[model samples]
Target: AIQIAASRDQLDPLLLSQAPGISFKYWKDATQLYLQQIDRLVAKGEDAKLAENKPYGGPVFRKMAVQLSLHDLKGAVTTLVDARLFQEAYVLSRTRYMDSLAEQTLRLWAHDCFLNGHYNTSSVCYMALGDLSQAAAALGKSSDEESLSLAADIAKVLGQTTFAGHIEEKREFIKSKKELLEKLDKQVEDQDLKDLPSRSELVIKENNTEKSQLEEPEKDTENAKEVASTDEKNLMSDTQAEESGKGEDENKIEKLLVELPEKMEGLLKDGIQNGMHKGDGDTMQNGEATDPQNNNEILAKPLQNGSEPVQEKSATE
Candidate 1:
């Protein structure tokens, strides 16, 4: 009921009195309500005199209320810190004199910011606490080269020579690392370029090999064709020579056949003449008169039978 009334901004003196008891259990809620009420009253230009004239009257009551409110606010700030709400806790605590609580909250907030990589925020927090060294160190965590270099210059101006030198050294290291990576990349590109011609040559050699492999059968076929043509030519020449030799042999045989009858007739005539001479000599020795007609018949009979003429015998034999 009290929380409901607080939320509605309808909390009376009766509910406000119960807030102290609520602080023991729900201190953060109670503190928040009390601070809101205080803010409202201040905004309305309410003074201590107006506060005292209310049902919660008297200076003693006012003082006790202030003390209790302070205690509750402190508890609320501690709760926020425990919840890792350091920024809220720091802001809440810084508005009042919470003794060492504000400084503790600022430190916690700075550390949280640093861990979360809010380097600039952490550096501001550290600077607010008058910690120049920690502030410069926080700024050094930034990735920007120009920011790091600027931070180094700022650190030097602020009399933090050691931190400035560290920042400068880190900046140089980052630059050198980047340069080295660029050089390595360039070298890899150059190597790839250098290998391109050899790779092309290898491709050409492979193509030539494949072409030769494909043409080998054709070359073999051409050689076979040449051999076949040469064989055909040789066979043709041999046939022509054989035909020519046969023609010459036929001519020689035909010539011999054509002259054969003439040669036989001349040999027959010589044999007949010798037979007549022999017959005349024999007739003279025998003293017989030669019958020319009978000799002629004898010669004619041999000629008719195609035989050589026989010599005439003596009349005594």
Candidate 2:
């Protein structure tokens, strides 16, 4: 009723003055008046204003009611957007408000000619609010590559690796484009597919270039194949030699293992026989040394008489 009366210019200031709390009388704005009533409701422990309540009614009524309670920031954002107060609308879109959803919307809207400044301002707001990812993204939209790089660096310092990486890539992409233009002396007039270095052609060039240089000794395809074949043959020969060396080492190890038992048994038999000879007190004792030839003859006589020791027999077996 008040709305209709006010719209028709039939509402009187004297009637509004009588209803101080119910009207926007002496209030800075309608939002302030609505918020005062909402505060009263909160003091009484009433609900329906907070975001979790999912307040009923359409966007218009809901927006007015939602801001009064300071919940569901998107309601205010939507309302401001509908009113075409894009600067204020974008200012409210942030991490504390709608998180990344608002950022995504602002990023898209920044492409507009009118709202482009708003996007840059929003970026400054985001940076002041310490959201480097959003700031870098906004700078990119404004084509400020250098500032974008700086924002990416700030994000890296703050340990936002994923956001920093994405921002850095955008900066690098712009940088590469600039470099390519400079290298071409700003002659971007080429339209032929063969002249342009497309991504697929680059991949093919890399794969094909790895094997042969542009200027090589062997130009003929058959000669190149033959050289490759020769190199392969050399590799095979080296491998075969290594295998043969390993086999020889195994055989030598086996031979040494077989001879070890025989050597031990022979030493044992010689010690026993020498002990028996010592017991006889025949020749070597005290300071006297036995003759090598006589010792050999004595040992040989026992073998010739078909009386070889068990140690010798086991060793042969």
Candidate 3:
């Protein structure tokens, strides 16, 4: 905190209590220091005589006044007005010089005091301070061309009618702003809602396509199972037919073997008789020679007699 000395005469009890809610710890410290200094100057011995000398009086008084002005920022306007009068008196008596920066600061504080809680004060301050646009902007009026035209037309109707007419007009302006914002919010909601259906539809379509794709494989698997079952049946039937044909062929072979022995017996009997007849008739030709007709008759005799041929006669032929 800054600490500067306040003059004893400038100290006022009511000023501290009447201060607004601004921070003024520096001023309180300065007041305490000034009181201590006064107490030191009035002390019993050597410092008392030194305090009466004019050597450092002017600078010290000026410093004390600056400290008083800093505190005055927290004071009421009435106290500030009294301080300004006091300052003017001191200047007139050539007791102290006013600092330009300090004077401007006091004026700014005075302006803040007057302007507190007043819109017109802000308007005037900004306007005089070469801030016309800011002054106009601070009024909270709409700058949009359409709103401005509407406000003007409203004002014109108010001029033609009663002064109170524009009160309702102002309410309408607020309501219109709210409605416009609501419409924009609803439009955004509608766009969001639109995107939802498309997203859901896409998801549904994809799910259906995937379901169809999965079902197709299942159907194909069923067809393949049926085909495999049919092929198995065909293979089993073919095997059964082959086994039956093998059994029939075996039976036919057994039947052929039984008939073959009987046929062979008839041929052997016919051959022996024919051989003897050939031997008697062909004796003149040669002992080993035989006629062709007699040879055939002898070969047939073995089968007719149903007996084995005689070994002696067979050897001679």
Candidate 4:
């Protein structure tokens, strides 16, 4: 009847009570046999379909239950750990006064969660393990502001002030770093805005440069022509002015030549009249005729002596 019930998947407390001679050792063996049979039948099914069915009322639970009933705490914990039910394994170990097993399970679970990026779960496991620094470090790895804040509060409540302070400092550092990045982004945007010229202005400047470049040779040629024309005009005007000036100079020289002989004859006539008047006065004062030849000889003697003749005074007394 027990074998029939185990085949029918009816391994309950009532069945065990009805069969008082059957121990948990026999029950564990029967359950494992039934699980093996179920696995063989489900082997051809898809993995999802097989996972959906709890073989033999969950192999881990059945084995753990059997081990617990047999007072085999270590076996039960081992069963839970093999099933990857770490939290339950730790709890069972702790409740059974297996301190070393509980700590070992917790550390294993924490490292597993940490390696799998389950930072919050790892943090809780580390906290349960009394490793406040690792717990805070795990929370820091989560990069969730609210989770870190909550962890800081929990740390404070647990009297882990230093870890709580470290968590707060890390949060502040992250916030400051975020603000600094935002400020740098804003500065970069502003600088880009300042450095970028308007499209129309840039186009216009490019066009102007192109047009100026294209027109330079033409403008240079026109300028050269204009300069040549101006230079020719200036040369013509300079030559005309020089010719007119030369003609005026020649006219002045001709006029001076025409007046020079007349001027010299007039000077000689004036000198002769003054000398004749002096000779008449001298003749009257001496009561004698003064000859022109003697006057000529007197003027010739003063010229030879390079001196002027002394004038004779009239006797009035």
Candidate 5:
């Protein structure tokens, strides 16, 4: 039993060796038999005696309940129902702390039974809990009593009595949908099967790309070296001259920058404070400023020869 519980995923031939009296040849078969026997005892309403057989029953049933919770309802319901029966048999002795959990477990068990098309079992479960609404609801009966003239549709359906089979059909449809969904999920998984690249192969590709990009620059440098080799004397002379020309350009730029602030300050002060003479009032026409005073200050600033002077400041400066 320990081996069966411990290694549910793996084969447990050791259970057969351990419990030689029983046919524990297959773990699945063994567990199934154990479950069936408990279910039978619960059905017979011998729940008190069933609970007394704790050595064989309690753990098996508890495991089964967990399995059902994980959606293995078909495999687990036999034992789960028995466990509920056992709990009911000892309801008075059962811990107050565990009452809600037991009720919730029974409710889930009822849902599983209904989902598996055991509506009679579901009805029994709900009836035992005194949940008439759910019991009748499971049976396609009305939750509320109504006057004959204002009867619920469920009452009408129940009166006809063919609706009992409809619930079974719905259960079967749910099973089929579950199977279909399983197949589709498997198909999706199969479709997305991936072959991951080996780390060494990925590393090799990355290293090759890096090497190629590095070699490209080296190749261009080599080409430049070869061209320079072919015209060594001319290359050397041209390089020296180019360097000298750059130095001269830098010096000239420095001189311009040094001279610029004084030149700019003088020009701006003269332009703003000392007004330029107009030729004559008649020489100018319309509303325009006359003669050299008519110069556009903003445009004229740019014409004063700083290559990249900004417009607004140069105008006001």
Candidate 6:
């Protein structure tokens, strides 16, 4: 808890080892040594003189933190506001849930900054306080178009259309820029929506292709086995047919060898018969055929004719 308190803020240290009289440097122009008079008055319980030179000062921070711990939040916040440390004042006011007091202090801070010519800070304070009118008015008095355009949007939201229209007309370039940015944002959203479905479709197609590829290897393996089996059957049939053909050819050769001797003997017998017939043909040519009937006929025919007996002439003669 002590560390948390010590670490709550760098400027607003939650815990301080020194009191009002034992101050450290918080401002540049004045140091604790110069404010020793105020410390002496605070130590002596002289409350009136403690705020003599300055109503709220750097030397009183320790006392303020002490007062906050003691639940004197109202006094602490009031003292912080008088010290012109609105940030600290606002923090205490917000933490303590003093809504009315916070609102008052916020307006006061904006008003103070505006009077001090810190229009941008004043605009921011007004924005934080949700006073869009004051924020737009304050930004209009400054030179930043973007922040002014933002204030114009707040004004539009609050139904200050005239102010919004005037701001948009004054900063036409900024208006066009904002429109272009809005157009780009919408286009990006539409493109993203379109890509969503295409991405899913691509994933589905890739998965289908992968599944087919996985199944094709198995199919190819089966086809290869079938082709191999058929090739083996054809090879075996071809081998058997070749062996049978060789056996048939050998049988034909053996049968031809066995019949060749008989064929030659038959040829020899026919040749001897033909030679005998040819030898008989020489006698037949001399008109000396061995037929007795032919000889008788020839003699009778000569006797009956009662002429000279005709003699047969041999073909050789």
Residue 70 of candidate 2: its Cα lDDT? Answer: 52
Task: Give the per-residue lDDT of model 1 (tens digit) for 84-114.
Answer: 7787677767776774899989998899999
Question: What lDDT would candidate 6 get against the real structure?
Answer: 0.68
Error of 5 at 202 (Å): 2.2
Candidate closer to the true structure by lDDT (higher is better), 2 or 5: 2
lDDT of each residue in 4-100, candidate 2, tens digit only: 4344433333223324334445333444444555566578775343324322344554454446345556666777666655556666676346657
What ranking of all candidate models by TM-score puts the best one first? 4, 1, 6, 3, 2, 5
Q: What is the C-alpha RMSD of each candidate to the true structure, in Å?
A: 19.0, 26.1, 18.2, 13.0, 25.9, 18.9
Task: Enumerate residue pairs that collide in model 2.
Answer: none
Model 6: per-residue Cα lDDT over 145-198, one tens digit each: 776678678778889899888777777766678789999999999988774457
Error of 4 at 62 (Å): 27
- In order, the Cα lDDT scores of the candidates are 0.74, 0.59, 0.51, 0.74, 0.56, 0.68
TM-score of 6: 0.35
lDDT (Cα, tens digit) per residue for candidate 4, span 198-303: 8999999999999999999999999999999999999999999999999999999998877765665555556766967976787798886656665555344322
| Residue 134 error, candidate 2, Å | 3.4
Clashes of each: 0, 0, 16, 0, 0, 0
- What is the number of residue pairs that collide in model 5? 0
**Candidate 3 on 1-317: residue-level lDDT in tens?**
12211343233332333232234664465557556655666574535443343332354434444445555332323343444443333233232243543444344533453445433444455555554444443332543444434434544443533422443455467778978999999999998877445788999999999999999999999999999999999999999999999999999988777666576655555555565676666775675654556555555544333344443334335
Tens-digit per-residue lDDT, 1-317, candidate 5: 44555344322233323343333355456665556656666798865644442333458755653553354543454454555553442242233245655566667768877787666567667877877546656655222222111222333444634544454455556567878999999999888886778999999999999999999999999999988887997888899999999999999999989788667756764654444333234244444444343344643554345544343432212
lDDT head-to-head 1 vs 3, winner: 1
